[model samples]
Target: MPIRTEAWPQGTPCWIDCQVDDPAKAGEFYAELFGWEIQDGGPESGGYLMAAKSGAAAAGIGPKPEPMAGSPSVWTTYFAVDDADASAEAVARAGGRLVVPAFDVMEFGRMFVAADPTGAVFAVWQARGHNGAAWYSEHGGYVWNELHTHDFDAAKKFYRDIFGYTYTDFDLGDEKYVTFTPPARTESVGGISDDSAARGEPAAYWLTWFQFDDVDAGAKRATELGGTVLQPPTDSPVGRSTLITAPQGEVFGIIDPSKRVGEMPAPTS
Candidate 1:
């Protein structure tokens, strides 16, 4: 696996972190589940715990932001950008709502939180000293990040406006799924899927996926570590994936992407 030493290109999913109520418990849970070396970033960094795989940063666990304090724990995927302030402006112009305006992270980076026109929240990172995730897609690291929105067209247009993203649409059964490739990139890094009609009334949200060598075993281990298996391991074009929630109720997925079981739809963007 390639270890990313510097920041990712603009518009890619550079990093992901969860804001939970009990930081320590979150640390212990993920550490045991992924065999991560979790360590607290200390008081200066608000006691944020950095989870590393082989001494390179893999993900983060930290207390909720002041605005979201006491809210339900959840994971947020961040896109890399050249200037967070400019990106925030782009978000506003694209009809997205800003939950948190761009702000500095003590020289590591600048970031802001915002909800897409369809109401799915995400963040953008302007890296400085800290260059986001050191590596991804390996076992115990993030594999995919996707947005599940109610207004698929609006969400697609909003992100495209913000990041110059081009998409290839796919028909996933009766629902629509589209893989997005950022500007100047040849491959898709993430996807946008809106299946709310089939899923009933679940609110729009971005889904973060982590990889596991054994999908079933990962789901079983999650339950033993105080987590809940929201959906038992299921297979699709993406692979065998299980929708699971952490002990604190933050939803994420464990999937074995190598386990292909179906034909993928051709691009229709």
Candidate 2:
């Protein structure tokens, strides 16, 4: 089952969560789609719900912060670090902007939100009692995270400086992509792509991909649940995948890796 009991490596993506206007509705949609159990954290937690799979924490759903009113619903990817304060300093030194200052999360961890020089917002976490998600890379769990940025070189440099990441570039005919892994890790943790032109949007953003058993079926179910299928199920070297915006307008992706587990290219530098 690949249940994770230990903390992830520093600079690895260790947790993800969606902030939406309606937490209960979001919980219902994901619980049915991924067979997850929603555990309410009660009032003091501001209605945060931990989405669990097979009785282990997999993700989270919570109400959007008051300051974010009228903004688009979105999922946030959090990277792991040994010290949130130090990471925040690194982010600043790398020309990134901090949206939220480093702060303790009860006894779970310390965290802060920052946007890369390219404007892609992400979080960093320092684990305490909660070491982030307990499972991943399985059906109904997170498999990948990617940042789509307009400034490719700046994005690359900012992340590399902050996280000590190494990159492997892929030449996919007309388009180019680069997979990144934390220092001393062989497995790719995420990727970076210059996709703003294709989407006709200049604002950079992070995308989260969850593993599904059937990509087509998942896309279909999403549409039936009042969600929008931004990209139809399509095959890639790695897997079959689709992009979707949930009923609450938060965007995410799903992939079925049954046919091909594509090999990542060797690190270019």
Candidate 3:
């Protein structure tokens, strides 16, 4: 079946944005690593830059909120919807909180930044002829989004209530990663997990993975572009994967898996 149009409100994988201390450095890092073209949106708009690939828009780069503190740099994924207000409402109704209430971006679109019950921050975009990201996963663009949460069931239930998502269970025996879909499709829109970290169990947060043709080559290029590798590419039950950080310190993932982002083969029993 085709992806459920009604459930998503807007199209799947609309756009992503990153808030960093240095936009110029971040722009240069991603431009070389992903083959993206970074164009300035000017200073009045916080010198926001659009990251595009092959002439199609992909993501955005902007300065960090002036008063924001204690948050590590990370890339945030935004899903497109038909109604930002309603989506923000749904988030609150499902036990999640609206970190940043719904607001407009001139004639661009309406947006509301939010966090899941487990504290994973993401955004919702309601396009008014100006959606967030124009292109995705074409050259070096965002291909997938995943969340590492402390409480899988609660997080799963929260998103299900908010977005009406169903899921596929990756039965890793004692533990599993339940990947969610927007309704009809088997492919995942995102994922939920519980993993160990330096500070005991890690807090819940969403992670985004950008696509690259070659995993090893991408890791090497990430280093060459002044980005740091958090986890070297290693074999996963799913694919070879690695964690990385841009020069501005925004964290993201890189995987040149055997399967495409939205086209993974069914998990075996």
Candidate 4:
């Protein structure tokens, strides 16, 4: 298991959580699918439930805030930062919009939400008592995150300005995929692609991928639990993967890595 004890570096994706209509039902579904031990965070925590894998924090589940009533359930990815206020300013200066202003989370940390120029929403966290997830890149934990957008150049410039990300493009025959590497990192922290044009709607959004021991079985179980399989299991260079929507309509991906463990790509100039 890749256990994370300290804070993730600035610009690194450090945490993820889903806002759902029914926290209990969502909790049950994920618990069965990922073997997570869902623990209530108590009244002061606003009923947020921390989903743990082998006693380590893996993800979080919480009810949708009243301000966001009637919105579809969706997961939000959070990137680590040293200053939420500064990050929020950088977001607006980079042509992105702030959905929420920076606020303290009872001293655990401060955070704010923003959308990229292409309109894909993400959050930034300045940790205090709480440092994000305790584990990642293992079975039942977050493995990867990617943004699907129509305006690749605009989105790339927005993120590069805000997070100091450098790009490396991979030629995929007819499509070119770009990976964003944080400062001084050899491996990419996330990716951006313009394939949303093929989806027929030109919608931009971030997709999170969780690791699974067996993706075929995981997809089957998800469907059996009232979830929808958007994409059937398919083999890829990285792993066998599938796209799934939870019972309440939150979409995420699952992958079973072909290699025993995943490796970050070598740094590219």
What is the C-alpha lDDT profile of model 3 across 34-129, one tens digit per residue?
888999977667678888776667789887765345566768778777788988888888988887789888777888888888888888888775
Each prediction's total of clashing residue pairs, residues at least 3 apart in sequence or on different chains, is 0, 0, 0, 0
lDDT of 2 at 251: 94
True lDDT of residue 235, candidate 1: 90
Q: What is the number of residue pairs that collide in model 2? A: 0
Candidates by TM-score, descending order = 1, 2, 4, 3
lDDT of 2 by residue, 113-187 (tens): 888988888999899999998979887889899998878889999999999998889866455689899996888
lDDT of each: 0.89, 0.89, 0.74, 0.88
**For residues 4-68, what per-residue lDDT tens digits would candidate 1 score against the true structure?**
89889999999999999998999999888888899888789987889999888899998898988
Stretches of model 2 off by over 4 angstroms after superposition: 261-269
Clash list (residue pairs), candidate 2 = none
- Model 4 steric clash pairs: none
lDDT tens digits by residue: candidate 4, 191-248: 8878744767436888899999899999999999999999999877688899999999
Cα RMSDs of all predictions? 1.1, 1.8, 4.0, 2.6
Residue 204 Cα positional deviation in candidate 3, in Å, after optimal superposition: 1.0
Index of the highest-TM-score prediction: 1
In terms of lDDT, the poorest run of 10 residues in model 1 is: 194-203
